[model samples]
Target: MFGSDDFKDQAVWEFSFRIDDGGFSWDYKFKPPLWKSVVGRTLSKNNDVLLLDASHDEPTDGREETSAVFQSRFLEGIGPIKGVIYGYHQGPEVLKATGNQTQLKNWLRDQTGVRVYRDNVRVFNYGEPSDDWLGLNVRRINRPGDRFGTNSLVAAISLDLESSYLLKEKTNREGFDGGGAFPRFVKLVLSAFERFEHVAIDDRKALDDVIRGKGTAVAPVRFLDAMDSLKAGVKSKNIPKAFQREIDAIEREYTELRDVMVSAGTAGLNLAVIFHEIEREVDALAAAVERKLDEQSIKKQIEQIHYMLHGFAPLLRKNPAKSIFCSEVIEQATRVRKSRFAFHSVVFSAPVLTKEEPDFKIKAAPNLLVGAIGNLLDNAMYWTKVRQELDASNGSRAIRVFDSAQGR
Candidate 1:
């Protein structure tokens, strides 16, 4: 009942049927035209065939209607079977219909209930094996020095029989018991199947060992492990946004510090000229204060001025690195900005180094460390001024600096 519209012109097939012993035999005559189509010309002899037992469970008490869809007709004493032959012409049209190898494989598995591996099939030219085997799971056996050219193509014969009484039926069959013709045919097919199964098992084992990094196969198991981790949702933290913010902050701080250093350099040069010209004047002013002023406050002011000038000198000088107490660094930075604190009326607090507390010391260039702290204080004072102008009632224009001891 094969028709061109049923399977398209790309379908080529053959089939056979037989009644009880010599009763009636039916087979498709492979005419000259079909024979011409069968030989792949440049290929080897291609009449390889496989036999499959398509047995399934008998219908249960309540599932008879559902199971009936898979049932086949009876062939007299040979049990129930619905015979069919189907094939696709291995041409561009077939490839277009199948789409790709993956789709072709899926279609095969859906129709045949078998898993196909890439190496399951091979073709052969004169005597050498190739990988050009066409559709219908045509697996080729590698036989060196075969004179069949490229006529070799593997095919399977699937017999759909009821599973519940399949063994009993086989034993009862006339030609199947006691090593008859049927037994020989069955044994030959079984042997072929056994060989194929062994090959499949070995192939699977090699693949498994390679995947686990336990064999000679040089697969990238570590890379596969990483891919597995990613599939399981192991993700790294997304820190670019936070990192960019920190970078921007550092850049802004650096720009301010550079501007401050440039201004200090100009002030330093002016101070040097003033120091030379006012050196004698400053001394005379201090002596006059000690001699005639007689006020302790005036004397302390003169000494403070001398101290401040020396402190400013180090800002432009090359101060060597040494272990300076953290308390001293904080005090030096605060001391330089003490007047600005008063001028802005901003409340400031700093840790008072006491005998009970351990003052931390850091090895650094004191001038650079003090300059960094000074820049921080400048930022705090600027923000504090802004807050006051934004809302006077808030009245929170304050800056506090503190250090912690390990135990405290």
Candidate 2:
């Protein structure tokens, strides 16, 4: 029927359909169903229009006179039309013979309540200069703009039934009528599908779009809107599921960061414990060194160790934040690595200050300031060593500390 021009306006020989996926299955009364290509395309484009038997003519040269003798007697005994009626006509009798097709379509829509397709209306001229023949191909039974599985199924069933009847040479004279029951049933099914789609399909799609980074431009505002809805106690079916998904994603990120922080803190604590044990042993050794001044080299090494211990001990202790001079931080940091300076022969310099001069003071945890200075010295020492290794006579390897004399 779909391939033959004769059956294009008539009916098919047979129609049948079956859908199955193990858990669900349905079968419709159709055999040798319309070609898969034609039916699949029609189902996929549920709302596309197909116009048949249309004509194109030149516009009138001038305004035509309105006829006053038109009568409604021809329509007196006509019943309501149930089938689609193409606005196309034969010969030269079309009202707007020279009018644009689009305008003509609009005029027909206005006069007859027919919905003209706004997309994909193809015109074929057959490569000749004769009057143009136009045709629109579409599924005519669907309600405009409504798309759902059940709606499509209903449409398919209607088409199959109509095709079956037409094949039997049935016409309106046979009094074949589909009552109000099927229409009411269609309304109920469409209503249920709409509600389910709003919550499950549409909202879930929104969540997927934002998660895949496809909707980044709208994500911030969408989140804000969700928050506003929550705060106002307005219940929205769409937001809750998407909001939960986003929350789970964010929580996973922060959980990873928290785990990392915990591991780092544990490692720091273990290092501090090792340092404390060394400090205890060194203290006992220092007492023994105090008893022997004859061993000057060993005694001096012990003193340097003591200085380093003093510089770092504050870091482990529970020291409250307080006002302290910046110079003290620099001094302690340098003191901790005092032996390195001599071993490397690196010159260290700082401004000489008297008790009369005010030094720069900062209110912070003393250990923080010491740690900051220690990092700077570490970086400086590394590059200074690199420079000396590159060229020994470049100059003396040195580190200098600067500060405003007025404590700015």
Candidate 3:
């Protein structure tokens, strides 16, 4: 009775399930971590969803139980895959609908290697589209909005992916990277999204030059190979914790790379081509959106973006020294608010809190956030230039920052 897409979610669950009216549905967020062991074992434990008792093929059919997992068999068999796993919120009806939890468990073990029992955790759906996109990016694309303008609706969707899937695990355990499979799953989802769309793309070679924003999203490259070096050192000495983090990172990277390799089959590419295409498509869309965008309308968008960036700057300067690294937070933001604010022309603001320092340190993993913000700023600037034609006729127009605390 389940659709192909529904099966796809089941294919990926490393082990958790939801409790609902008739039965439970699998949690897609838990799958990617399972593969970490095959590639490079991670130190983090699996986010087990289902508890399984898998049986062997022998006549006696020896059995072993594993609650949280996606046996290889299941992954190969499951269906309706979307671009790597993004956040999935079960429709309330789906939760209430009857599902044979026992039958589902047997199907998983027989088809795939995963198994699940039950847990105290209640299913909580992150209902935002942006949250879904961010979850998609944890494994695919360097980060959200890296391929498009941050202020673009696409960016908002990408933000959701970040929050729902990646943020929590990272916050939960410093070493979950080994067990972290979300990023890898994201790669698979992105590949799947484009795979079915059949949109022939041609210009991704420019992504290299595209500083699409957010520090972590920018493909983290450390100055000193601290992680690698530590790994080697640990190999020589049995330092359990020291090498664990390294192992986790390596496992995550490997899983992500593997997913990308599989997905990139026909469309796989580096940055250059990707960026060029993204730009072209965006421009084409912008041109369509407006014939002659007056200076005020365009300026409002830029101003909003700009103020947002300025607000982030103070936060960047705060303690722990984490840069307001995201492109949006670091760069200026200028947006055209749907409705008029006190400043009807443009509304610019920072995405992060500035001025006052928080008790906890924030690592503004620069690339995704900063890059997205910058994209918006760049677009706003472009609109401003077009709007400036008024100055030649008679008067000079000025732009000012609204958030005084932002120091813009």
Candidate 4:
């Protein structure tokens, strides 16, 4: 009954059966198996297990399923037993049988998926290393990015024998008979895993990107492209129109989310640049003080630094949409670049704003705007230095920033 081909592998598996005692009922006065009750008591408090009762209304009127329509109705009414599923790695502490940290870690490393329990007794070979009851390992090997392997989870499905009569165990005591309710049980379990994988994969990818310093920019683009490919592949198959519509909706949502991430990432990168710029200025200020520069010179430098920091106040505000004078933003950015320009022997030319233009304000995140300008200055300084080296006559390279109306 437990042939390799008979039972296909999956991330989630179902073990449905009823207790021998007729008194057991999920609705009222339901006595859970020792293992199930223990698990509910122990793991439920820690939120390790996600309990779902898929119990449906029992057929009131007894009707013989003689016709195909009646058979379909009967099948629809049949629901799995009330069971709880526990996902490992969903929390900080991994599930373990022993209290020893080393032993628990070893168990997590060695164990393969969830174990099965029937009437407080563990069903052997179900979650054993050699057992691939749900084909979790197989699916993981095929699609590593989206599937969880054997070591990643632990779960148990318990059912009473009297309530789950349709799920019959094989004569060899290996597994359930692969007939009638068995296939439906497998389908129900797989459906839950399918929903879980959707969210899990995104979280996994996001973490990986952060660790590798790749940022969130690449994921959305790749996801959208993959969706397009999947949509095309699904179109070739004889799938329903609703499936296509759902896919289209998902694609649209991903696109919007990608845009938001891109905008946020850009702002973050800008802020990083501004932070470095500030650090450089602070270091220079510290150096002048240590060198025991003249009091007047030191005071002037301190005032300049103060002015630069004062200009950054708008950028540091909590409300990013606050407006600031465009001229002031430009002046602050140019001030940050002054030391670099002088060190590189670059002749820098900045625009002179008239009285009328001084009042011109732009709605932008102050730090991001300054960071963008700083990056432009960095590029200009680099290219100017290159030009200076290439031409002996050009001892100093020039950078000019002017408004178009000025024609300078």
Where's the lowest-lDDT run of ten residues in candidate 2?
50-59
After TM-score superposition, the amount by which residue 175's alpha carbon in candidate 2 deviates from its true location, in angstroms, is 98
Looking at candidate 1, the ten consecutive residues that score lowest on lDDT are 65-74
lDDT for each residue of candidate 4 in 190-232, tens digit (9 for 90 to 100): 4345435543555455434443456554544577678888888
For residues 1-408, what per-residue lDDT tens digits would candidate 3 score against the true structure?
665456554421122222222222332222221221222111222232222211111111111111122232222211212112222112222223325444444333333211111132212222222334323333235433233211111110122232234323335432223233433333323333332112111112121222233233366566246567767788778788855876877867975675444334212222322344334335544664476777776665555445444443422321222544333344323222212122224444443434342222337433333334444443443344335532333233233323344564
lDDT of 2 by residue, 1-408 (tens): 122232212211111222111111122111112322212111122111111111111111111111111112211112111122211221122223323434443433333211111122211211122211111112121322222221112111112332222112114422222232222222222222232222233333433343345653553556546555554552444546666666666666765665455444433533433364346447656776677645765666577566766666765554457998877877766776665566456788666333344467889767656666665775676567555544545577898776765464
* Clashes per candidate (backbone, < 3 Å): 13, 13, 102, 11
Residue 248 of model 1: what lDDT?
Answer: 56
Q: How does each model score on TM-score? A: 0.28, 0.30, 0.20, 0.33
The regions of model 1 sitting more than 4 angstroms off are 1-294, 352-358, 394-396, 404-408
User: What is the alpha-carbon lDDT of model 1 when measured against the actual structure?
Assistant: 0.41
The TM-score ranking, best first, is 4, 2, 1, 3
Q: Comparing candidate 3 with candidate 4, which one achieves the higher lDDT?
A: 4
* lDDT tens per residue, model 1, 1-408: 323343222223232322222322223312111221222211111222222221111122322211111112222223322122233333333345433535543343334311111122211121122322121122222212211112222233333334213222234332123222222223333333332333233333443343344645355556446544543442354545665566556666865776566556444433433343245346656787767876776666577566666655555655657999988888777765665576456788774544334677799777777766776776677666545544534565698776655434
Predictions ranked by lDDT, top down? 4, 1, 2, 3
RMSD of each: 38.5, 35.4, 23.1, 28.1
Error of 1 at 171 (Å): 99
The per-residue C-alpha lDDT of model 3 at residue 15 equals 20
Model 3 spans with C-alpha error above 4 angstroms: 1-24, 27-408
Q: How close is candidate 2 to the true structure, as a TM-score?
A: 0.30
